[model samples]
Target: MPEHASGASSKLIVESVSKWFRTPRATVHALDSISMQVAAGEVVCLVGPSGCGKSTLLDIIAGLTKPDSGHVLADGHLVTGPGRQRLVVFQEPSLFPWLDVFGNVMFGLKLCPELTNDGRREIAHRFLGLVGLEKFERVHVHELSGGMKQRVALARALAADPQVLLMDEPFGALDAMTREHLYDDVQRIWRDAGKTIVFVTHNMREAVCLGDRVLLMSQAPGKIIQAFDIPLPRPRSIYDVELVGYAARIADALRGTVGGGVPE
Candidate 1:
């Protein structure tokens, strides 16, 4: 663990968390005594080889999955289950086919029942615009391109006004060009929204580009092996020379942990 792993100013805390999976064949240990903290409005990226429990950790923090041991806290409160304050944007858009883009975003606001219908609708449109999809509000999910669908998913997640945003490789399925464009969009949105983000990715460069801190995980049962503070200037480019240097260093560390080649 590093100095930044946990601190008094932390917004999200994972204390000695662990998890396991039991099946007919065998019981697999997926996580081991994981503990870390995410500061408010900070962006942290988790990177590791496949099957390293990266997604599992994200789910635990999101309260989508319960830890077998220990616990997680958000804003000094225990995370018993999913709450409106924590939202996830998964790899796939997972939008409803029956709903248009605006309808999809509006649906996420269902979590915020305190708001009136008109207020929720306004928020949906505002988030759609933030993600540069206001014009496509009426477009059906099936008609949108892969990147467009992901943008809609982001808008939906943001519309809920979650205090913490958990993203599990939201851009993994897009083409290279689309991903590059999205890298910029995500940075802008994150800055403007000032939301705490826990992003999980297999791409080292992507992590370096977006993270204020990059936490490397070991193979299952996953543990936070190293934390690299990226003090680089904001609105980073994936292809920047300095950014590439950081990515390469993290990639070397990743390979050492996995005992093989690093994921893209």
Candidate 2:
């Protein structure tokens, strides 16, 4: 585990963030004046259409990409670049093929010369177990299924004891069955670990399942069209979504976002 400054803010804040991409032919407006805040320990999911800049916004929050205008903050401090304090878990496993599960998970720790070998091992093992991959620690990344690979990536991120986890559709590539299983696993690990997570996805159910609040984005110039505080309490599973009105509210929110900001 890494050092945690006592009494420091862990909140994530974004203010008037706008990002425009310059392609070979034309400039595209990705995000416009996007502002949002997620308190420490809050799970907020960002959902939008294909070109609505959902992932771009996530990149800004993670400091993987810089915004042309506005600011991104973590713990009330501006986020400029990637740091161990904020780990980004991608849709697929981005492990080094040359390294086995253990080596891959321990890669970041290896660079942090401050931690001892024993310290790194303990952290890696704890997170692997947290994601139900303790038995697979010695396995190669190539041998793992798509779901398992993503789990490893997630475990790698979790092993760092991140204050804020930035996940970009971490299950988007998995089959429905596997995605649901991983969804349950993710929910368990996130709650048990008490992490502040910002998950991005187009799947409405996934958003509702993972987020304490769901923020829906509009077209190219993404902005929050609607945000709903999930009334259902955790330990909330996919099965619990049978509530009559909950589905409609979520569906409406999803449609409203992708339907180009029009109220249905």
Candidate 3:
């Protein structure tokens, strides 16, 4: 947690968090006393080595798994379980093959039927266009490219209208070019929409380029070892990336925690 605490952080707070899992063979301590915070509208990226329990930490926050101890508070309210205020986007699109793009995006609306059909469609279309999927509204999941599907997932998350978004390697499976494209898209939408996002990835540059504050975690029983505030300006282009030291600066910190390097 560097000194960027000027309060632009979106009101996401995790206090003294820890989690463990029971197994037939033995018990495993997945996370140990992890704590951090995301100021409003800030992109806080978490990066660590393999098996560092990064995903497990995410699960705990998303309320899919409860921590053995500790608490999570969103916007000054305690989080007991998954709420409509928090939306998640996983590495996969998590869309139903049976549902078309529009239906998939509107799936969460089932829980909020109070919203009229037209109202739901209006919000869905706005987010879809943000992800460059305005034309694929009627297309089914199988008809989309990897990037397009990711966009749909993003659109769905946006449609849910959550104050905070949880993203787990949303572009980890895509090619470099596609991933970079989505990276730019996410930055644009995140800034304009004024939502708090917590993203997890093994890609250091992806973390550096998108995060306002990047948190580096250690191995199992994970903890934050470094936090860097990216001082670069917005809209850092592909060709201009070399001029920005964000990638290199964060790479050094990540390599320390990774105990080597995950080559690009």
Q: Which candidate leads the pack in lDDT?
A: 1
Sort by TM-score, best first.
1, 3, 2
Report every candidate's CA lDDT.
0.92, 0.80, 0.81
RMSD per candidate (Å) reads: 1.2, 4.8, 2.0
Pairwise TM-score winner, candidates 1 and 2: 1
Error of model 1, residue 127, in angstroms: 0.5
Clashes of each: 0, 0, 4
- Scanning candidate 3 in windows of ten residues, the lowest lDDT window is 1-10
**Per-residue lDDT value at 126 in model 2:** 88
Task: Please state the error at residue 92 of candidate 1 in Å.
Answer: 0.7
Please tell me which predicted candidate would have the highest TM-score against the true structure. Answer: 1
TM-scores of the candidates in the order shown: 0.97, 0.90, 0.93
Q: What is candidate 1's local distance difference test score?
A: 0.92
Q: Give one digit per residue, the lDDT tens place, for model 3 in 154-230.
A: 88888888888999989989999998899899889887898888899987778877888888888887887778887
User: Which stretches in model 1 have alpha-carbon errors above 4 Å?
Assistant: 1-6
Give lDDT tens digits, candidate 1, residues 157-237. Answer: 999999999999999998989999899988999889999999999999999999999999999999989999999998899
Question: Candidate 2: minimum summed lDDT over ten consecutive residues — where?
Answer: 1-10
